[model samples]
Target: MSKQAVALTLTDLNADTPCCPPIAQRRIPAESAAVLAPAFKALGDPVRLQLMSMIASAPDGEICVCDLTPAFELSGPTISHHLKTLRDAGLVDSDRRGTWVYYRARPTIMRQLAALLTVEAT
Candidate 1:
């Protein structure tokens, strides 16, 4: 299946539980780790982490780039760069509407990250 198809399929799964066994129970393949590493790296910055949270938790399910920029001390272009990084990492999707871009979280990746981090009680 295509990567987009796989992402959609994974998002349809139960959210209360993980789709894969936790990291403690199974090792992550090098390929999978490589794929996920960018997402982790994108979130390593406090600005990017806050940006992701803002995008993910937006009441309308998406937020305009205009709205996102004012929340930070950085310049608009800097914020755009961070958003581009998030886009490159596949953690968020963006749509440009006329002059502004809107961003929304990609649930599939969020779920994948959550699944990997979940620690089941012993």
Candidate 2:
């Protein structure tokens, strides 16, 4: 391939203008580490991680709180609190349909997290 064509992919990948270089290449910047740290922090708890997976892998992209509560041995309020934490972190969305509240993973942030963690060898 031509030199110009060869450079295009690198340019396109760096187009986002990330503060840190790629994860495989260099240490992630403290600034970026700060921004994404919460996401990882939010997932640190086992209950929260399972909640995320349940929401992300749910059929129809959503699951009811009614269903989520029973799956865990915790109280309704505890599960609700965890769900709220995920919602506040911009990881999930909740909507009340009649009597029950349903939650779904936010795909935009999911994609961004996936892209950020993606390691493309130079």
Candidate 3:
């Protein structure tokens, strides 16, 4: 990926139109691939994938780090590291509240990802 590709962001993709069609429909553009790669990489990990699902499905549309940690056998810092990766990938957003950090999925990026994976029925 070129440095130029690195500059593309999830927000750079239009909400009404995805940067590219479903990967099954055709090849993903270099720019779109670059923009989406980080998110795909972040979710490539089982732990992070699970974390994302939990955060995305939370009843309040957000979840606390405290609540997340108890579901896994890993150490707190390990979970925090995974959460940081998701945030860095723009897949999630975080807010510090007292001792716990709250996390919520970024719906725009989530939609972009979902669109890319969507395969229309033939």
Please report, in order, the local distance difference test score of every candidate based on alpha carbons.
Answer: 0.80, 0.75, 0.87
> How many backbone collisions does model 2 have?
0
Worst 10 residues of 1 by lDDT: 5-14
- Looking at model 2, residue 39 earns an lDDT score of 65
Which pairs of residues collide in model 3? none
What's the distance in Å from true for residue 4, model 2?
Answer: 34
Residue pairs in steric clash, candidate 2? Answer: none
Candidate 2 regions exceeding 4 Å error are 1-21, 120-122
Superposition TM-score, candidate 3 onto the true structure: 0.87
- How many Å off is the CA of 117 in candidate 2? 2.4
Superior candidate under TM-score, 2 versus 3: 3
lDDT of 3 at 122: 79
In model 1, the clashing pairs are none
Report the lDDT of model 3 for residue 104: 96
The best candidate in terms of lDDT: 3
Q: Which ten residues in a row have the lowest lDDT in candidate 2?
A: 5-14
Error of 2 at 32 (Å): 2.1
Which candidate achieves the best TM-score against the true structure? 3
